[model samples]
Target: MAPKVLFVLTSHNKLGNLDKPTGWYLPELAHPYHVLHGKTDITVASPKGGEAPLDPASVDAAKDAVSVAFLANHEAVWKTTRKLADFKGKAADFDALFYVGGHGPMFDLVDSATSQQLIREFWEAGKVVSAVCHAPAVFYDARLSDGSLLVEGKEVTAFTNAEEEQAGLTDVVPFLPEDALNKASGGKFVKGEELWAEKVVVSGRLITGQNPASATAVGEAIAKALGV
Candidate 1:
C-alpha cells in the first residue's frame, strides 16, 4: 500500500468576543493537500470531527486561479472532513504527519495533551512530522517521556515575529511562533530569507516550513521522506 500522510488541523478557538478570524489558513492547508493528495495517498484529520474553521483573512490568498481551482477540485474538504477520532491505528501507520497553521492554533493546539502524545508516537516511529507557520508552537508543550525537549536540537522554522509584525497581527494572535519556538527549543531556532518566501528545515525525520508559502515545499519533502 502507498504511504499515507495525515494533515492534523486545529478546530477549537476562543468563542465569541474577538472579531479576529480563526481556523487553518486556506493556503497552508490547501497547498499541501494539493501536493500530497495528488502525488500520493493522504488523509485529512482534525481535533474536531467536522467543520474545520477557515481563517477569513486567508480568503484573499485563496482568490487566485490556482487556489480557487484547487479548492474546486477538493470536494472532500468541502463535504467530508475527517476527524482524528476515526483513526484507530497507531502513529506508526502513517508515513508522515502535517499540522496546518493559523491564528486559531495558538489558542488550542499548543496546550493539547492528545496532540502531544500523537506527535511523540509519530516522531518515535520515524514518520516525517511537519508543521508550518503558527502551528509549530504546538510543540511548546510537547515533551519526551524522558523529560527531554522534543525539538531541542532540531532545526525548525515557523511564523516569525517579523512576519507577524509585517501583517500587523502581532497582537491579534495569541503568541508569536518564532519566540515560542526559540524559547521552547532553548534558542535553537533557525531561519532563511524573507518571511514570505518558501523556506523549510529538515533534520533527520522532522520537517518544518517557515510559513504558509513553504507548504508545497514541505509536502514535497514529506513525499521524498516517504520515498513515494
Candidate 2:
C-alpha cells in the first residue's frame, strides 16, 4: 500500500467579518494536493468535520496557467473539502502530516485543541510535520519533550510580513505568523526572495513554505524527506 499522508486543512475563514472577498487561495491547497494526491494515499481533515471555507480571492478569475490548472483538479475538488473529524488521525497510520494554509489557519487552526494535539502527537512519533503559509502559526504553542520550543533553531519559513502587510489584513489577523514564528521560535528568521516569493525551508522532518506560491515546492520537499 502507498504511504498514507494526513493532510489537515482549515474549515474557518479569518475574513469572516470582512465584507471583502476571500477563499482558500487555491494554490496553497491545490498545488500540493496535485503533486502528492495520486502518488500518496491522502487523507483530508479540518478543525471541524464540515466543508472548509475557501478564500474567495483564490477562485476568482485568474488568467494564469497555475490558477487554471488548480481550479480544474478533480481530486482536489472531490477530497479536499472535508471536515476535521471525518479524517481524525492516529499518527502511526500515516507517514507524514501536512497542514495546508491560508489566512483562515491564522484563526481556526491556532485556536484548535485538536490540531495542536495532532501536531504534538505526530512529531512525538518522529513523523514528518509540515505546514505552509499561515499554517505554521499552528506551531507557535507546540513544544518538545525537553521543554524547548518545537521549531527552535530549525530552518523554517512562512507567509512574509510584507505579504501580510501588502494584503492589508495584517492588522486584522489573529496573529502575524512571521512575527510569532520568529519570537516563539527564538531563532532568526530569513527570507527566500521577497514578499509573495516562492520560498521553502526544510530541516529534518519539519517543512514550511513562504507563501501560497511555494506550496508545490514544499510538498516536493515533504515527499522527498519522507521518502515517498
Candidate 3:
C-alpha cells in the first residue's frame, strides 16, 4: 500500500485584522501536492471540516506551471477538507503529517490544541512530521510526550524573517515564523544565504522547508523518509 500522508491546511481566512484575505499559500500546497500526487495517498484536512480558504495573492496568473496544474487537477481536495479535530488519537493511520503554510497557520494552528496534540502523537509514533513556509508556526507551541518543544534542538527551517519583511507582512502577521521557529528550536533553525532560496532541513523524522520555494523538496524528503 502507498504511504498515507495527511496534509494539513489552514482554515483561518482573514489576514491579521486587515480587510485582505489569506489562508494556505497555493504554491506551498500545490508544489508539495504535485510532488506526492501519484507516489502516495494524501488526505487534505484543516481545523474546519469544510472549505479552507486560499491565499488570494498566491492565485495570481503568474504562478508556476505546477501550481496551475494543481489547481486544475486537485483543487477539489482543497475545497473540502476533513476537520483536524477528528484525527486526534489516529496517528498510526498516517505515515506523515504535513502542514501547508500561509499567514493562516500563524494564527490558527499555532494556537490549536488539536494541532499540538496531533503533532505530539505523530512524533511519539516515530512518523514523519513536516511543514513548509509559515506552516512551521504550528510548531511554535507543539510539545512532545516528554513535554519538550517538538522543534527544540532540531535543525529546522521555515519562512524567514527577512522573507516576511520582503513580503511586507513583517508586522501584519501575528508572529514571524522565523522568530517563532528560532525560539522553538533553540536557535537551531537555519536558512539559506539569501531569501527565497530553496532549503529543506531534515532532522530525524522532522522535516521543514524554508519557504514556498522549498515546498516540493519538503514533499520529496517526506517521500524518501517513507521509503516510497
Give the root-mean-square deviation of each candidate in angstroms.
Answer: 2.0, 2.3, 1.0
Comparing candidate 1 with candidate 3, which one achieves the higher TM-score?
3
How do the residues 1-228 of candidate 3 rate in per-residue lDDT, one tens digit apiece? 999999999999998988999988998998888888789999989998789999888898327999988888886888889999999999999999999988888888898999999999999998999999998888888998888989888898889989999899998988888888898889998999988989999999999999988988998999899998
Steric overlap count per candidate = 0, 11, 0
Strongest candidate by lDDT: 3
Question: 221, model 3: CA deviation in Å?
Answer: 0.6
- Which residue pairs clash within candidate 1? none
Estimate TM-scores for all models: 0.91, 0.89, 0.97
TM for candidate 1 is: 0.91
Q: Please give the range of 10 consecutive residues that has the lowest summed lDDT in model 1.
A: 12-21
Model 3, residue pairs in steric clash: none
Please report, in order, the local distance difference test score of every candidate based on alpha carbons.
Answer: 0.77, 0.76, 0.90
Better of 2 and 3 by TM-score: 3
Residues 1-228 of candidate 2 have per-residue lDDT tens digits of 777888777766658577664534677777787778767888878776456677777766343666677666554552455665544457878888888887777777876777777777789888899988888888887776577778888767888788888878877787788888888767755567667778888878888888877888988988788677
Q: Mark the regions of model 1 whose C-alpha exceeds 4 Å error after superposition.
A: 13-17, 85-89
Query: What's the residue-level lDDT of 173 in candidate 3?
Result: 87
> What ranking of all candidate models by TM-score puts the best one first?
3, 1, 2
Better of 1 and 2 by TM-score: 1
